[model samples]
Target: MSDRPATSRVLVIVPAWNEEESIGDTVTEIRACVPWADLLVVDDGSSDGTRGAAENAGATVCQLPFNLGVGGAMRTGYRYALRHGYDVAVQIDADGQHDPRSLLSLLEPLGESDIVIGARFASKDDPYKVRGPRRWAMVLLATVLSRMAGTRLTDVTSGYRVCNRRAITVFAAHYPAEYLGDTVESLVIANRAGCTVTQVPVTMRPRAGGRASHSPVRAAIYLFRAFVALSLALVRKWPAQFEDPVAP
Candidate 1:
């Protein structure tokens, strides 16, 4: 690798749980789309062969000893990215939803923004009747939080995203663990820390394999918990002190 600026290095993190059906293909497809990116699959206590499949597909694998949920696995990935000195870190789900080709579009905003969320509303593939309610709820909550926190955001629960070194440093240090809306904890924390955040539309597909962990009941519980947690977090001022793991 050339001794280039940190901004040029990108690492893609996929936090997977029992996704043996899609992990290998996801890694292969991502490598095909962004060959320069270093792919890391954080296997969140998968009993299946997800780790083997990802490794055979040529991605660097980090298998967590226990199931840490999405937020925990993602934070682990951020730590890996920071330790490895990656200039950028991107999160893509292992369930075949996040389009690998759209990674570049997500990463593009890093030139101006510290973090970029791949908004699904921009895609024509979204069925409004189904996604509309979820979108509305997220937008409503995000707007309230943004106004309260003195920040702006488009998609608060988006899983597809890219973050530059500035973001990796911040997240690796103080990322909230639970009750954070599907990845909304990071968005809120980033905003609180004054990190530039932007949203880009990305086409996401239904998982080709395995059932989603979130059912209607689970989603409701998650939403209620997230709202309460964010309300508390929004009121506090996050100090801007974070350690850069890769600093010499």
Candidate 2:
């Protein structure tokens, strides 16, 4: 993160799936931390009362008809932001892992960066550490992506980040919903499409409630998928027309 810029019309998108217990609290906390931004909870086909919880907590809810994972929900949120004339978009988890207070720090680099990632490992005294195969995969991804981006990125898989209009436009048009596409491949697409990416240190909290999508036992699987996503991203490029989503 680098230079600061004037910001207007910010939307905080939270993708929730059966996270009724934490969605309400997450919304309230965000409203407390960043009261100026609009909140959108993309309920990813939750069978529970996630929609009601979010609505009661004072968020606009967009309930997906079925579960499409985090990537799909985030793509929907990006499109919603682009259509609603919002100039900035930020993705925060409904499980309470992403701290809302650090949002301002993440936005600090907006003028200098098109996409800013809230990297957990880059922060001081950060407790959210991944180990085993997952940690190895993260290191590899960060190393490869850092070389590609010409910057040091400690956490390439982080979802806690902010995007300006340029980044939003690119994502709205070509964001993928594949396994690791949202965080990994999407960055590749953005870089290929000529968007600048950077990251800032952020302290993430433990999940307040809800189930985790990945477990320790699944670290090996995640490692494999991460490589696959990276491979596809390296070989493929965003189409030429997506260079500018706002042009008529």
Candidate 3:
């Protein structure tokens, strides 16, 4: 556990879309792992019973009018965190691939940095591996982001992460609003905004239910789009701080 004050509010933000089978268990596991933290599930217009399942599992539900992908859903959570005056916020996948037990490890570094990514590839002992084209793509992204941020980043696509108040404020204001935009682009934005970003090794588990949103065809399309986005991010100038307060 972090040495931060007990009153330091921590929120676990789970973005779910048709994850009815696993969202409930994901919420329950998070409660068990971090009993003091509040839970918020961003239901991204899930057609199934995801919102009800999350509510039953003891999480506050934030329903979107339509599916806005992970980036939009997480941005909603960030806005919520800022509005609620939370000291820290963590994004956990609703698919149960992210281990709740690793929350403490991710939070331990938040005292020194604005963001702490729970990196799957950061540990050599971890058996999880990204194979084929995806593996190559991650390597390329990691290399680019590492150079841009002036820090080593092993997992550019990992969603398991913790962010402090400053990070939440920045993200709430200008988070990327496109598909897969939450991963690499968010890091670039954070670094450009003068937020210290770092990573900690964490083991990832197989998804508890449902299939990944990415297929081979989708992955190819994402690669081209990601390249274009990353290039733009590198040249774009950003403000030193976020001035606009997000309205609840």
Candidate 4:
């Protein structure tokens, strides 16, 4: 377990969209793994009973009236963390692909950097293979983002990440607000805002239940959108000021 400050307030933010099949179990597992952390599930207008399931599993549900996509739902979580004065916030996927047991590993790096990504590709013991076009796309994104952030990034699209107070504040205000926006664009936003970002090796499990949101066609669309978003992020000027820097 991380030897973080005892006063640090940590929150586990789970963004769900039609993940009723797995959200409950995901919440339960997180509670078991990190019982001290508060849990919040942002239901992005899921058509099923995702909200109720998450609540029943002992998570505070933040229901959106309409579909806002993952990026918007994540922004909502960041806003909540900032408003509640949380010292750290971790983003966990509702699909169960992100292992709750790795939550502590993700938090371990927050002492040295503002953001720590739980990178799947960083793990040597458990090789999670991404075959076909999706694999190629991931490689391209990782290469581009690594150059932009001035650091090696193996899993650019990984959702398992921990962020400190400064990151929460910046994300709450300027998070990307579009489809497939959060991953690449948000990294650029954090780097441009002068927040240090790093990654730790983590093994991921296959989704516990329900269909994957990304089909082959969707993967292609995401790649195109990601490219556009990254390009735009490159041209955007840095904001005049950011949130107060937090001590490592």
Candidate 5:
């Protein structure tokens, strides 16, 4: 594993939709924590003033034409990072569950891997927990993905992730835009395209603002959705394997 410097040109991309409540503070915290990195908030056609809030908090906001979900927003971010000549790209939720302070540690493994996942449950000490079917779905996904990538990945659903230039190139062109596509399917795409993956344990916190999107009560439905996501990811045909066309 090559050791990457803490000073690599970094772009922190935050995909947001109607996150005006938390966008400002999230931007502020990222700037305060990773001051050396550039911040971009891809506002996914929010009906609120998310763009203005992010700009006021000192982040460059990229407004989408319509709501394309987190997957589409991040695809834009990948393209932006590739075009602007950034060495690293990191994606964190705009809701603030992903702590900005963990970002540096998340990027540490990039020298040796194409992707570094800021996993929420890699360590036994991590207190973050999902109960019932949600937990089962996540565990099932992790077990299968770990085997596929030849590495133990505990939290495949977590959105906090860091990617190097090579992974960015692959994602810029072929990142999925479907539901659950950003985290689960994206990893499969990266692995299939010959990218290496690793993880660092991190604890998740309560959202700084906005509402939580998860509800464990819908057990059966959630489990079925998870299965469908994984099945679709496995059966989909990738036209041509990504081979880092851009010089790194």
Candidate 6:
């Protein structure tokens, strides 16, 4: 067994959508990696047996009323974490791409920093087809957004991340629901709130089952819409009155 952090109160929130093939394996692997973590699987109205599989794998399941996409499901988990008073909450994708063993690296920055995101390209294992023009555009967009937000955030599209109690509270209250661009939006919100954001390298692979939800056409449209929404957020100062030390 790997050594776990003593001060870290970690909860693994997995958002699932027809990931019956991988949910059980993913949960079991996460348990093996961080036995101390409280695993919660948010079933995003999957037609498959993802919910049951996750429960059987010893993970606490939260079935969403509807398919709220990744961001909404993640916020549901975040609300639970806040209500339960967890010190840290980490988001993991339902697909097998995100390595469970890398939980330690993700949480290390959370000890002192407010939020830590996993940088996928730090050790890229994604297929070139998956990493081609789409991800390239995402990285460029993230870089521009980071500069505007006064931070140098990498991997703004990554699903793996760890957040402290303060960040959890902030997100649980006002997470975006329209699109699946939580990474960049969350990073921007945290940065504007004066939260210290950091990144750690992580290894990721392709999904185990089901096709990717975002097609190339959908991705391009999402990118333009996301950019507009984020721009509006920046101009409006939407996530208002966030200070360094949010009350516990």
Q: Candidate 1 vs candidate 5: which has greater TM-score?
A: 5
Off by over 4 Å in 5: 1-7, 243-248
Q: Residue-wise lDDT of candidate 3 within 1-248, one digit each (tens)?
A: 33334568999999999999999999999888888899999999999999999999999999999999999999999999998899999999999999988888788787899999999888779999767666777888899998877889999889999999999999998888775579888988998888998999999999999987667877777677767777877777888777648654
In the range 51-125, model 6's lDDT, one tens digit per residue, is 999999999999977798888898888888987878889998888888878888777777678888887665555
Q: Which residue segments of model 2 deviate by more than 4 Å?
A: 1-7, 213-216, 240-248
TM-score of each: 0.87, 0.94, 0.93, 0.91, 0.94, 0.87
Each candidate's lDDT (Cα)?
A: 0.78, 0.90, 0.88, 0.85, 0.89, 0.78
TM-score of 2: 0.94
Query: How many clashes in each structure?
Result: 0, 1, 0, 0, 0, 0
Summing lDDT over every window of 10 consecutive residues in candidate 4, give the lowest-scoring window.
Answer: 239-248
Residue 186's lDDT within candidate 1 is 70
Clashes of 1: 0
Candidate 2 structure quality by residue, lDDT tens digits, 1-248: 22223657899999999999999999999998888889999999999999999999999999999999999999999999998899899999999989888888888798899999999899668888789999999999999999888899999999898999998999988888998889999888888878899999998888899667678769999898888989998998567557445455
Measured over all alpha carbons after superposition, the RMSD of each candidate to the real structure, in angstroms, is 3.4, 2.7, 2.1, 3.1, 2.9, 3.0
As for candidate 2, its clashing pairs are: 2-109
C-alpha RMSD of candidate 3: 2.1
Name the 10 consecutive residues with the lowest summed lDDT in model 3. Answer: 1-10
Question: Model 6 TM-score?
Answer: 0.87
Clashing pairs in 4: none
lDDT of 5 by residue, 1-248 (tens): 22335668999999999999999999998888878889999999999999999999999999998999999999999999998999999998999899888876888788899999999878888888788888899999999999999999899999999999999999998899987899899998888888999999998999888876566557768788899999999998775567554556
